[model samples]
Target: MSDNPMPSSFDGNPEFKEETAGQKLRRRLREEPLIPLGCAATSYALYRAYRSMKAKDSVELNRMFRARIYAQAFTLLAVVAGGMYYKNERQQRKEFERALEARKQQEKRDAWLRELEIRDKEDRDWRERHAAIEAAAKEAAKGGPRPAPAAAASAMASDQSRTAEAPVEVSEEKKKGGVLDAVKSLLSGGK
Candidate 1:
C-alpha cells in the first residue's frame, strides 16, 4: 500500500481544483457564522451586565463575570474587522478607477501619435513629388542656352520699372468706394 493518498480524477482539472480567496471566505462563512454569534454574545453580555447592576448582592454580580468580559472583547474585535474590510474595499475601488483613467489617457496618446504619423507620411510624399517635378523641369531647361547673368539682371530691372510706371486701374465699384460711401452718406444725412 502506498503511503500517499490516491488523487481524484477531478484533481487533474484546473477548474475543479483550486478555490479563490473569496470562495474560501464564502465557504468558511457558510460553515460557521461568527459575526452574528459575536453580536448575540455582545448583546447577552450587556444584558448580563445590566442584570448584575440591578442585583444588590456582590456574589450575584460576580457570577460569570469573565464570560461577559470575553464576549465584549470578541464583539469589539468583530467590529474592528468589519471596519478594516470596508477600508480595504474603498482602497481597491480607488485603485481600479485610477488605473482605468490612466488606460484611457494612454489610448488617447496612442491615437494622437498615429494621426501625427499619417500626416507626416502625407507631407513627405508631397515633398518627394514636388522635388521630382522640379528635377524634371531643370532637365528640360538644360536644352536651352542660358542667358548672361548681367543681361538677366538688367531684364528683370526693366520689367520692374515698367510695372512701376504703369498706373494700377481700379474697378468702377471699388473706385467709387462702394458700400462704405453709401454708409457714410447715409450716416452724414446726404452730406
Candidate 2:
C-alpha cells in the first residue's frame, strides 16, 4: 500500500550479506593465483591420499601395521634360522665323513698288521720244521738212533703236505679282454 516497494526477505537477513563460497574462491584465485594454486595442489594431494586409504578406523590401521610387522619378523627369523641350520648340518656332515675316513684308514692298518703277524708265524713255523728235518737227516748219516715211528708219524700227519719240498704247479688266472671283446662276448651269450 506504500509508494516504495517492501524490502525483500533476503535484504532483511544479515547472513545474505556475507560472500558466497564460489565468490570467495574466485576472489582468492584472482587476487593471489600462486598461493591459491599451491594450496589447491596440497589439498588435492591430501584428498587423493584420503581417498586411497585402505583402513578407515584407527583400530584397523593399527592391526594392519602390526600384522605386517609380525609377518616380516617371522620371515626374517625363518631365513636366519634356515641359514644357520644348513651351515650346522654341513659342518656336522663334514665331521662325520672325516671320522668315517679315519676309521676306514685305521681298519686298513689293523688288517695289514694282522696279515704281517700271520706271515711271521708261518715263516717261524716253517723254519723250525726245516731245522728238525735237517737234524733228522744228519742223525741218519751219523748212524744215530732213529725217532720213534709213532711220534714221528703223529708230528708229520698234521702238516705233511706243507713239509714237502716238491715243485708246485701254479695255475694262472686268464686275463680279461678289452671292452670290444667283452661286448662281442655278451652278444654271443658268453661264448
Candidate 3:
C-alpha cells in the first residue's frame, strides 16, 4: 500500500481492511515483490521434494532437494537487499520529521518575540503618560495656571480607551506604589 491511506466508505476499523487473497498478492507484488516470489519458489520446491520422497523416487528426490536449497538461498539474498532499501527509506522519513519539528519551533519563537515587542511598546506609552502627569502636577504646585478641566477629562478618556477590550494589567513598575500614590501626591501637593 502507499504511505497514505485511501479514503473509503468503510470506516469500521483502522487496523483492519477486507481484501481477497488475489488483491493481497497484487498489493504485495507492487512492493519488494522479488522477496515474495523467492519465498514462493522455496515453498514449492520443498513441497515437490516431499512428494518425490513419498513416491520412492531417489533421483527426483535428490533433484527437488537441490532445487529447495537454491530457492532458499535466493530468498535469503532478496531479504537482505530489501532490508537495505528499507534502512534508506527510514533515514529519509526521520530527516523529514526533524525538519517539520524545527519549523514549528521557529514559528513559536516568532510569536513570543512579537508579544514581547507589544509589551515593550505598552510599557513605554505608560511611562510617558505618567511623566506628563507629574510635570503638570509640579507646575500646578508652583502656582502656575492649572490645565483646563476639559484637558483632564480627555486624559481620563484616553485611559479608558486603553481598557476597551479588558482591564490593563499593572506592569512591574506600577506594582511598586501604583497610580493611587501618584493621584494622592498630585492632590496633596507634597504635603
- If scored against the real structure, what TM-score would every candidate get? 0.31, 0.37, 0.40
Best by TM-score: 3
lDDT of 3 by residue, 1-191 (tens): 53223233223533334456897578657757888888899899889989999999889989989998899899899888877877865465455545546656767755765455445445556787789788889999998889998998798678657735444344643455544445445656956
Q: Please give, for residues 62-86, the per-residue lDDT of candidate 1 as tens digits.
A: 6646666787787678767765766
Could you tell me which 10 consecutive residues in candidate 3 have the lowest summed lDDT? Answer: 2-11
- What order do candidates take by TM-score, descending? 3, 2, 1
Pitting candidate 2 against candidate 3, the one with the higher TM-score is 3
Q: What tens digits encode model 2's per-residue C-alpha lDDT throughout 1-191?
A: 63223234333544333456897678646644554444454455445445445436556555545555555555566556555656854465455546556656767765765454444444545676789878988998999988897887778665555534333221210132333344446656999
Q: Which ten residues in a row have the lowest lDDT in candidate 1?
A: 2-11
Predicted candidate 2, C-alpha RMSD: 39.2
Residue 21 error, candidate 2, Å: 85
lDDT of 2: 0.54
- Once model 3 is optimally superposed onto the true structure by TM-score, how far is the C-alpha of residue 51 displaced, in angstroms? 36
| lDDT score of residue 5 within candidate 2 | 30
Cα lDDT, all candidates: 0.57, 0.54, 0.67
Report the number of backbone clashes for model 2: 0
Which one is best on lDDT? 3
